[model samples]
Structure formats: C-alpha cells, structure tokens
Target: MPYVITRLCTNDGACVEVCPVACIHTRPGAPQFYIDPDVCIDCEQCEIVCPVDAIFKDVDVPAEHAEAIDINASFFRQNKAVVGPVAFETAWQMVQRAHAYAASVGIAVTAAVVDEAGVPIAVGRMDGAAPRTAELAVSKAYTAAAFHLATADLAAQARQPWLRSLVVAHRGRLLPAAGGLVIFDGITIIGAVGVAGGSATDHDVLCCQAAFSVLETGGH
Candidate 1:
C-alpha cells in the first residue's frame, strides 16, 4: 500500500526534503500534502521524518485521518501539476490584489507574500501607512510560513522558549502578530501572505484573512 499525508500536516516541507524518490508533493488547493501512490517506495523515510506524525502507510492511517488514503491517490490521478508561485503570476500583481481588498474595506495597509521557506516575494504598502508597515507585513508572512499556522493562532505559543528561539534563529525576523497567515491551495501549500495597517485592537487580522480571498482568486 501507498503512504498518505493528512490534514494534520503542517506543510513544514520536512517530509518533502527527506523523500528519496521525491514523490511527496502538495497539489494545488490541497490543504495538506499528499504522497503519490505510484512513486512512493514505501521506504518510510517520510514517516520517520514527519514532525507532525501525519504520514502513514495506507493501511496504517488512523481512523481520524483515514480519508487521506483516497485523498492522496485521487490527487495523483487527477491533477497534472502541483500549484506553485508561477500559477499566481508576478509578485506585483499579488500585492496589488491584497491591497485592493484592503482598499475596498477603506483601510490603508501593507501586504507581503513569502514562499514556503519564509522568503519574501513581494511587499507593498498603501499611502498614509507607516513605512514600517512593510516590515510588519514581511515578518508576519515569514512567521506564518515558518510556524505553519496563522500568526494570530501562534500568539498563544509565542511566549514559549522554543518558539522564541526559533524567531531569534531566523534573524529575529518573525512576528507572531495577527496579520500573517499560511496560504493553502488544496493539499498543496502555495505560500503565505501578510498584511498590516490596522492597529492591534482593530482590523489587522481581518485584513490578513481577507488576503486569502485575494490569493484564492489568483490576485485578479
């Protein structure tokens, strides 16, 4: 039987790096990763490396995540390519759409997009926004991608020593603030988006979540 990846996956890309056959991948719009049934060697390298313990043999998948078996197989049989940045066009367009959403809501915000590795792709700020808004935007995106969770959700764990060290190790670049989020396209991870403009008590998270709709629509 083949291996499977379930929703519990953090999309941390740990299993992807360890797969010998390179069969582990996330299809476009897939909320979590999937193991290609045909190419998986059943060598269990991924299972050993999975930090979330989300990978399992088709037969061994626990009852809670059992749906992954068919989800993984059907993904390989359906789509021809995994969703990546190329599908989202250039970074400029992405930023524009993010701000467009912000504009519609009468907010002056800055937006940033980062790859799965937490590298910045684009950062755009609207007029009347503080210059540092771009910094917050980028840091938020980085934090989200690195932790594989929305920054707001990470807030409760932000005070943990391990998480604090993680931030320090990343050159003090991560911000476990409200405006960052992981962007998922099905089981595959497209990347992350961050927006900042509103105050801590106001629309920061609202604007950040709105960016998801912008991203899902291909930023058009």
Candidate 2:
C-alpha cells in the first residue's frame, strides 16, 4: 500500500530525508514534503525519526482527516491541481482605508488567505502568538471561508438556542464574536482571513479590515 501522510504529518521532512530509495520528493522548496507512494518501498524506517509522530500506515488514517488523503492522491493528477495562494501585506496595505472604515481596533493580527475550496492559499501568524494560536487562527479562517459568511454573522446566527444547538450538533466550533472575515472579490469568494490573540470582536474586525484592504488593493 502507498504510505500516505495524513493530517498527522507535521512537515518535519524526516521521512523524506531518511528514505533510502529516495522515493519521497525533497526539492529545495515545497509545502510540507511528500512521499511519492509509487516510488516508496514501504520501509518502516521513516516511522523512526519523525519527531511529531505524524507518520501513518496508509490504511490507518481516520475518517475525520480524509481530506488529507485526497490531497495527497490528487497531487498525482495528470494536470497539476492548484494548491492555494497567500500573500502578506503591511497592516495598512492589507486593510486599506482602515482609519476611516473602522474606529475601534485591536492588536495587529495575522491573516490567512484561502481558496474557494476552503484550502489555505496563504497563512500569516503574527509574532508573539501563543503556541497553538496559529492553528486556531487558521481554523477560524477556514470556518469563515467554507460558510461564505463572516464569523460575526455565524455567531449571531448561532445565538439562537436552536441554531446554536444545531451547530453544536454538527460538531462545529463556531465562536460568536469576531476574528474572521470571508473575502469576496467581485462577487466571488476568493479567500478568508482570521485573527486570533485578541477579543472575538477585535480579532474579527482585524481580519475584516484586512479582507477589505485586500479587496481594494487586488488581494494579499
């Protein structure tokens, strides 16, 4: 079976570096290294050096992380599929007209840009964030992008006991505050940005401002 890097893979590159057959691709620049299953010999050595314990036998991937499996499989498509896009900008450049548009603001927040399919195109976690803050920020951005709605809007909708119940029923962690913005470019949901390390409203506004700035300046 072709060994797949599930969500457990943390981009450590240990597997890529250790492969004796050199089947795993280890080019100078690539998003989290990948193993070319077609070239791999199923050696268990890769399982040894991984620091994050991310390696998994192909059949062991859980249902919740199935998308990772699909991502790996699709990389072999005859026509290269678009992975995603991300560009960072100065706070003002990203959120243009911020001084005029928003009165109350919060700490400078990092932003993530995602594609239509809810895959990250780019991510930026501002310096000094808590250890897991990056992951939280990305998750919020993805949540905003997938529903094509602002985080605040979702929060508002969830305020209804029934709606909140339904959201919880689906096992969604929809926070009711701020910190995420669904990006739109000329009626197309091009991406989303989410901010953490601040109040819900603060984070939401920061991300929204960034989204607007990106729209004005042709994206970042």
TM-score of each: 0.58, 0.46
- lDDT of predicted model 2: 0.56
Weakest lDDT window of 10 consecutive positions for candidate 2? 95-104
Q: Rate the local accuracy (lDDT) of all candidates.
A: 0.75, 0.56
CA lDDT for candidate 1: 0.75
Q: Which candidate wins on TM-score?
A: 1
As for model 2, its CA RMSD to the true structure in angstroms is 15.1
How many clashing pairs in candidate 2?
5
Model 2 agreement with the true structure over 163-188: per-residue lDDT tens digits: 46544743664444466676655444
Show model 1 residue runs off by greater than 4 Å: 1-82, 86-94, 218-220
In candidate 2, how many Å is residue 209 off? Answer: 0.7
Query: lDDT, candidate 1, residue 184?
Result: 69
> Which lDDT value does model 2 have at 21?
40
